[model samples]
Target: MQLLKDQERSQRAIKALIITPISLFIMISGFLLLKDNHFSQVATTLFAIVWGTVSVVSFFYSLNLIVQVFPLKYYNKIIPFVFVGPAILILGWYLFIPTLRSLYLSFLNRNSTAFVGLENYKYVFTDRTMLISFRNTILWLLFGTLFSVFFGLLAALLAERSSIEKIGKTFVFLPMAISMVGAGVIWKFMYAYKPAGANQTGLFNALMVAFGKDPQNWIGTAPMNNFFLIAIFVWLQTGFALVVLSAALKGVPNEIEEAARIDGASEFAVLMRIIIPSIAGSILTVATTILLAALKTFDIVFSMTNGLYGTEVLASQQYKQMFKFLNYGRGSAIAIIILLAVSPVIYYNLKEFNKREVF
Candidate 1:
């Protein structure tokens, strides 16, 4: 019996040694072939897809066969690393490496030729436009997050009792289907300004003209215009907030809510003292999500007003500094600042998610 077991283990080890290298070679060869355009482009694409698919299938199969050579205890320990190693490597290569490079570039000059320490950060803090951008970003974080969560909570509360909950959710979630740029374009038309005598193409201006007020440039005002842009973001994000918070709300034990009502607690009291606390994690999740979005807002500002009219945010300023003005140092500094601002909220969000998972 001992001799038979030894012979079986040796045979398995030999088979694994023979198959693993062949599987690896096939996978590499398939990947190389997939990158080539020597044949008709469509035919090459199709062939590569098949080749890659088969290679991956065979590779995994051979990997499992190789794992059989290991004892059960060793296989269990090694299997997790085998599955998770590629993702860790990819994240390090793409995210961690690039982030370090950006941080290093922040101390370099515009052409990245000379080292100019602290100058970019100084410019970011003291520049007039950048100051306005900081103020506007605060406003975006404040009002955008507030109104979005507020309206989302309101919608969730209302829809929970409504017969058409699914329909209501669908309509509210429709705006999320549109990209930020598309939403900006849609709202841009709504806020378009035309002179009093000519036809008012913009919906808001036309309504104003019908009410006998003169046509106004909605996107040309200073702080008020900033709020207008924030409104657009709120409109776009409220649905997401609603979806998440509503799910959280649904998770609240109905017995607790009923008991509160039975104890003579008002609906408002129940909501404030019981319901809100129950789903506080989800609320924080949505708030932090919107907060990050507001901080790094660029697309709507870029597409709608191009950050003119005191509407700049950190992301827009960074983009203009880097691409338009060719101020790479300043751009990198702004990016670092944005990352710093976002990191705390990200940490809190992840912590909340992890806590929720544990519970």
Candidate 2:
């Protein structure tokens, strides 16, 4: 019986191994054929939809068959790979491989042909524009994140108590719908500058003139201009933090707050000792999310100031090095630096999520 069972398992394994390759080959060949043959736009779309659905189903079915070929003892362990293996492979191919390539390219010269070693990294730290970018980015990370979370938590608390909670929250949250570039363009007009004697067109300038002040160049003003950009980030991100923190606040037990109040705790004391501590995890999550966004801030700066007048962030600097200057080495080095800067935050965020069983 044991000998017969072994023969049967061997036969099944051989059939699975053979069939999996043949199915994959046919799947690839059919996709190539479909791609190569020109069809009308609607017809091509239809074919692609059908082919995609069929291909996914067939591929997963083949994977399951391969997994089933394993012995019973290993079946549970191997089965998970049938579902997760494709995602792992895709991430490895697209994300991991490119990261390694960027690291390698960071060591090369401008043309990516000759070895330059740490010269690119040296320039990244020592270059005038790069230093300014680092400063501005740090400001963005600090102020942008601080104001966003602070205002968001404040709004969430206020909205929870307001009679017209939905209406107030809706108005505050509406900015979250605007794209960063769209917000930048809208604010650009608000900060638009003209000669002092001329009529002010920009909203801020017009307001300044209304208040008997000169229409100053808002975007052109160094150091402070970065804060103005940070304001846009705060505007866009605050709504997100509000929604998340509001939900988290709701999760805090009312009994705890009531108990604290019964014990003669003030509103502020209750907030500090009870509510905030209870929702600390959510606040940290929101802060980290905003921090990552601030770290990678590019669209607004690019759209409004184009990294001019000390408004440069790491992302905009990387863009300039890659496209404007066509310096691959410096670009890759800056890219790696940005990656390294964000990696710790990402790891911390993931660790927190793991502790919370979020995944």
Query: TM-score for all predictions?
Result: 0.89, 0.89
lDDT of each: 0.90, 0.92
lDDT of 1 at 158: 94
Residue pairs with backbone atoms closer than 3 Å in model 1 (clashes): none
Which residue pairs in candidate 2 collide? Answer: none
Best by lDDT: 2
Cand. 1 Cα-lDDT: 0.90
* C-alpha RMSD for every candidate: 2.8, 3.1
lDDT of 2 by residue, 1-359 (tens): 88877787788788778877877886897689687877888888888888778778878877877777777778799888878989899999999999999899999999899999999999999999899999999999999999999999999999999999999899899999999999999999999999998988999999999999989999999989999999999999999999999999999999989998999999999999999999999999999999999999999999999999889999999999989999999999999999999999999999999998889
lDDT by residue for model 1 over 1-359, one digit each (tens)? 87876787789888878888888888887667666656798988788778878777777677777776777798898877766776798899998897788899899999899999999999999999999989999999999999999999999999999999999999998999999999999999999997779999999999999999999989998879988898899999999999999999989999999999999999999999999999887888889999999998899999999998889988999999999999888899999999899999988887876876853
User: Which ranges in model 2 have alpha carbons more than 4 Å from their true place?
Assistant: 1-50
User: Looking at model 1, which ten-residue stretch has the lowest summed lDDT?
Assistant: 30-39
